[model samples]
Target: MDECSATKSTSLETLVIQNISNVKELKSKLSEIIKKGKDYEFDVSSCVKTLIKSNDQEIVFLTVEAISELVKCDEKRRTYSQKEIISPILDILQKEITTENAALIKQCFRALGNLCCDCDSSRKIILECGGVPNIINLMKKYFSAHSQLSMYAFKTLLNFAIGGQEFTNAMVDGGVVEMLQMVVIQELEKEEIDEEAVCALLSLLSLINENDTEILYSDEINAGVLKVLTNTADIDVSELCLDILHAQAEHDSVKTLIAKHGGIQVVCSRIEQLMQKFDHGELDADQSDVEAILKQACDLIVIVLTGDEAMHILYNKGLGEVYISMVKWLEHTNYHLITTGVLAIGNFARQDDYCAQMMDDKIYDKLLDLFDVYVSFGVQMQKEHSVLHPIEPGTITKIQHAILSALRNLTVPVANKRIIAAQGRAAPTLLGALLSVEDHHVAYKLLAAIRMLVDGQESVARLLGRHKSALRCVARWGHAGEYAGAAGEAPRLLAWAVKLLTRGPYWHNIVEVDGCISSLVNMLVASHSLMQNEAILALTLLAIETLKNISPSSEHPEFDYEKSFISQLIKSEIGKHVSILVDTNCAKMPVEVAENLLAFLDITSKKNKLALDYKEAKVTESLKKFAESRQDLSEDLKNCITGVIAAISDNGKD
Candidate 1:
């Protein structure tokens, strides 16, 4: 920075150039220049270029060391890359690699690594120079014999891999995947493992997989390696290994293989061990590192236990302690950790045995408590400008989705359903979640959980239906934009609520709820055929209730069935939506829906005014076109269409 310091730096480089013929002095000056941490001065690059071509291996090695240190800066890396020095260094590497010049070869590896640490262009040059195969060869050659060289080679390849897909593909083409797999298998098969080497190799393999899933999907990881590495005492190796397993878990067969090789026991074991350490504050690694390892382990548990076989192995053989440990995530502030714990419990709740076991453990009550905490915390944050802890909204949405989905899965067992409904907290908690949902995915999960809980449990359905705000919430979700998840799932929930409530003593209360009819009418043309049929069934059920209300047994004469309910259905343009469905989606429309639609039209169009409106709108024409377009119409559907047309014409007669 000063003139004297600049002159001193220049004099040092001049001394290197003056003593260029002396290897010992050159090494000393280069080491001194490296320590100075100077950028790429023209004098430095030019002198290093000349010294790199020396046949003396030590000169080449020291020149490379100088290049490595100089390229530590972004501008220097770019400058040296443009100086055309990488090709010469690579040339020397190719020449020395054949001769067992271990020090020079290792230094060349280090230099190449530093050169391409974050430089994509330099990585391209190295790959173009066939650096990958040479590095893979060195890795293969020295993997079993020279651990240090192998590590440098692995780090260099990892640097190349940081360039992403192109460099990763090169490594794969040059047998890098196979080379790393071999390293893992070989090292794991030995009596004593090199934790660092295996961890590095697994890290490389995990990176490659992350960059190219096609390669990872095709890679057949050794079962023995999976078994040993998963159970390895080394946290780093086990963590990296689980990351690969998590990526490969996308393929069900890979999940099966992992389970068959005892992946569940080992993964859960690691989870339990780390959780115990965390609980006792006896973490052996950095807190963040411990959390990362624990997160990866929990991720594997969430994925690998998705299959029935894995679940069977887990609950049947008693991996219950791991589930207990996962439940402890509730006490942590990390949203991801809490979400993963909830997801794993969801996977475990797939079967009756575990659901019952979890119910007995009061896991359901604890999750409900956690949900209440989020709700109360949210309120507190709104009330107070600052709080002791603040959670991101996105993370809060994720936690909500996970908790709702887990509750949904847990209610799948028939016995658990009754107990959950009997517990009295599920309905209100679920309704609160549904009301608080701002994300479509979370709305979908909450609706699905409510739907699952209300499937055959009439008491729960009526419980959810009793809340008018809950009914309105379901209706809003039914039309929640084009997010097919909530939109498609909401109708089923609404239909169940309506069907159950219409049969209960509160039929009058539900029918008066605003937006309920329009929501069902909108669902009549839902892209999901089942949703359309559900709307039809639910509407028909509501129309049947309206007919009952209009009959002699009608108790609530003060409420106008025609103006309040039927007029709302007509105003919602139910017949128009039905016409569109018949005209556009005829061939794809289910026969049951057609029959049910005709039955619903017949029921709702009982009044002469409604029939006249249907006739004027040519709803009959659309129905005939629908009948003509659908050649696969069932006999029941045909009869229903005829009966509906006749009933409409008769009602329309002046």
Candidate 2:
């Protein structure tokens, strides 16, 4: 900065240096300056230029500190481009502007780290300005002597390597991969582990090839990293170590090492101890940070045990921690953290001992509570045009699917139904959630969860009566999905739609009013056996309930709508389809399916006064043909067919 450049901004330089540390307390004053737009950038540049000329360490440090807070948020980051902020920061890192104060050097590095973190352009700018090589050089230089300071530069570089295969290859080319494993190996077993350096290296392996035997998969590296993790005192460091090991868990060698070293026991105990602290009010100093690491610990546990043997170990050692963590996160307000918690539970459920561990447990009640929270979140999603801010969309969805999956697994044991029914809202909440979802993929899993909840629990079915309207959304989805036509989506949908209405007596009115009858009509003749059979059963319920509600001879206007529905049902070709379905047992619809079909036919003939279509069309021969042809048919189905023949004969006699 020349005298002319210096003279033009002396007062601006003074103001920056004076208020740097006090900026947070006088945020409005700083915000007013940022409100200056381009002038703010120019003013900031001029002040830094002048401060650098002074050759004062404290002043430059203050300037770097001020620069940091200026672009602390997205709005500010966007305003200060790489050319203005990063170019200067790069110049400082290259030692063109030198500082003996470690605090100043660290903060200068901190400023660069922040600049690189939030923007895509920062990576290119840093690389273009030779910042990447210098950053790597600085990290390598400070790594052993001043590891805490090195951690800042390493984190910045890690943020750069987050995406773009090109960037990773560039990092590898720059010796970043070699440097990471060595640093991790060297610093891991010391009295106090360099967690930041170790964690940064651990995170980088996720983007690197964990299978490449040259570096990450080497014996020395695995044993060293595994040893540090299994024996580490800090819960957070152990969590990071679990992450690195998880990336390699796919390899048999890694699994053997981790299990032999008691890594599974270590993770379980750490998670249990950390969560107990949370339960006992020990994390009050930093609840959010503790919760965040808790989520990481939970997620790593999910990925670490990649085999049945490992899963068995985790199940035996980690059940109490898994249960406690899931309950804590399910009740947590942070949607992202909750997913990892759910993931931990879901992975545990895959092993019988693990899944069985939760049988008849009280923990599922919180899962039911999560069902309520997600329903509200789903409904809110429909109401808002934008969501998942401050949280990743993938994170939120992964968790939602995890919870549904966990519930499905838990519900596989019959006694778990008591937990769901105990909360009264779990069944209804899931039903209503189905109605509001915009994502068909999540809806698919949620439907499976709902099926499990109400499958054999009559009380759960009865509870669904409370959310009749959203359950009809189930019908709407079935209606739309059936037309998707031979795609996997259609049958998957029809399966749940049938499950929803298998307790049809509880939801018949909303089912009819919401136009589910049209979709159900299509299912009666569907090509899939599952859909066709469930359709027949669902129709039986609808026909029986509709008949019970409205008499065909009634003169009341309200009865006219119901009568019109009967006419529509007949017109929809249900009569013809039912006769055709009963005529064949080659597809092997279950006996209850035939019984329900016969029951539907009997009730329809009794109420509508229409001649039995199958018999009227010469179906007496078709029934005898089918009954004799299929000896493999169940005896109950034989009995149902005999009863159907009797009903038809009685009708003819009249």
Candidate 3:
């Protein structure tokens, strides 16, 4: 025998007679045996025999407990052969299935569920031994008087159904649906029944495929489920029903049933009721409860508005009017309600006609006004106490995201661009919020909005250019914030800004490429990894553009900035020091390090113009490569490189 079996045998008598006084001691011994790495079948079989023969109920319970642990071990270790030893224990449980010792039978069924979950053979054995019928009988006998036992049986049945399609089909054939329906109906009639039963039914229905849902619907099993979802007083039951409906919303038949049973309307009503409670301050009774309700409401609205057919139904049913009214009401509340209302309105605005109607009604102005209000609030707080309002971050983030989303739907690019430009330095307020908010989802939304605004005309682009100080602010907050700046999200926003300034028509008219380049190069020189990546990305864009626009001996007076910027970039460690690569912060910097460094280098290089031999070699090498490559070199670039070469050669001659 293996060490596991030896340990099992040594403890068999103690488990069988219930003579062990210390529960912790027994658990410790069993745990040690399990860790011994040995076959425990013989010991399990011996314990099974002793448990069957013993008349002590506690001993029987102890033996079942030991067997359950061994079964779990076997499953984890893939010791399938050892499970056969528990077959006799099933017979003992079968003997205890009568009304008198129903509690004992319930424990045995719990053990069987655990065992079946592990061993396919054990599951089949359970089925062959009439486990389903026994559990069903128990479900009926104790479902009313003994709620705990009924819950046990319900849980066991759920486990059985989980064995696979065969078990699921067997369960359906064995009147499990009828049993569940009866319990659901019974629970509805009573003032109280086990919440566990409701949870079990929901779990069971969730596992069923669409075909099963169809079968259940055809058999009228859905009525009870729908009734509970639509009419129940219990919020938990209603929430579970909504979950079931949402999961099955994709099925045509289920969608029809939901529509027929008023699922959407009921959900909408509940949301409106919650909104009303929120407006009246009644929802402030419990923060957790309010949050849960809000989350459920959002999920339901998203589901209902997801598909075209459902959305059409919602619009035709006047959900749009109700939703717009809600948004109007939410224009002055706390940030949470405002955020939720904004999301709901954004979803509704996805339809072009509906969005046009909203625009016609001046919803965009109201939202922009909310943004102004938040900015004013932030500024006021900063002036009064020399510190910004604590809630200003979240408020700004939500309002910005909402306005951007609404603007995207409005599709009036010129008007939207003007609105974004009007925000001026306040645009950095949203960036500040992105850096400070604990929730990444909010930050992601805010970044998306910033991306849209920055991608517009020259006015908006220039506004961003003036706020170069804001970039370092984001970097600092990201470094000190709890979530490590969410690398994937923040970089996309930064990259989007860089891409826009490089490619957008607004690039030349509004942004000083040199100043932007300096800021980006400084960020690249920082210690943050995300900041460095974005900085390099911006630099790469600049390089690509520089290559495209510069040519040999062809400089225009207006190209002075480009020539001077590229010369400075190439001369400093900003290009050569690989260690300067840090993460992207998408915010302000601590100092104008990149800009100041470039200025310093330009002044010194001109003063020491005749003392730079290596500079000539470097410029000459770059020019030779650019010429030989046969690539389309621009006039400005060629002149820049040639001028650098001439300057260096002149310095070398002195």
Strongest candidate by TM-score: 1
Q: By TM-score, highest first, what's the ranking?
A: 1, 3, 2
Instruction: Give the worst 10-residue stretch by lDDT in candidate 1.
Output: 216-225
377-484, model 2: which lDDT tens digit per residue?
655655665754444456556667777888877777655666566667677667667666656566667766776777666666655544656556665666565334
Model 3: per-residue Cα lDDT over 557-620, one tens digit each:
4554345555645444442332222112213322233232222223323423312523533534
- Candidate 1 or 3, higher lDDT? 1
Cα error, residue 402 of model 3, in Å, equals 4.6
Off by over 4 Å in 1: 1-40, 43-62, 82-84, 94-100, 189-192, 217-239, 257-290, 317-341, 352-400, 413-443, 482-484, 501-505, 548-555, 612-618, 634-654
Clashing pairs in 2: none
Candidate rank order under lDDT: 1, 2, 3
Candidate 3 has what TM-score? 0.52
Candidate number that wins on lDDT, 2 or 3: 2
Badly placed stretches (over 4 Å) of model 3 are 1-151, 157-196, 203-227, 242-264, 272-287, 303-309, 316-322, 325-329, 332-335, 375-403, 408-515, 518-563, 568-654
CA lDDT scores, all candidates in order: 0.75, 0.61, 0.54
TM-score-wise, the better of 2 and 3 is 3
Q: What is the lDDT of residue 654 in candidate 3?
A: 48
TM-score for all predictions? 0.82, 0.50, 0.52
Instruction: Determine the backbone clash count of candidate 2.
Output: 0
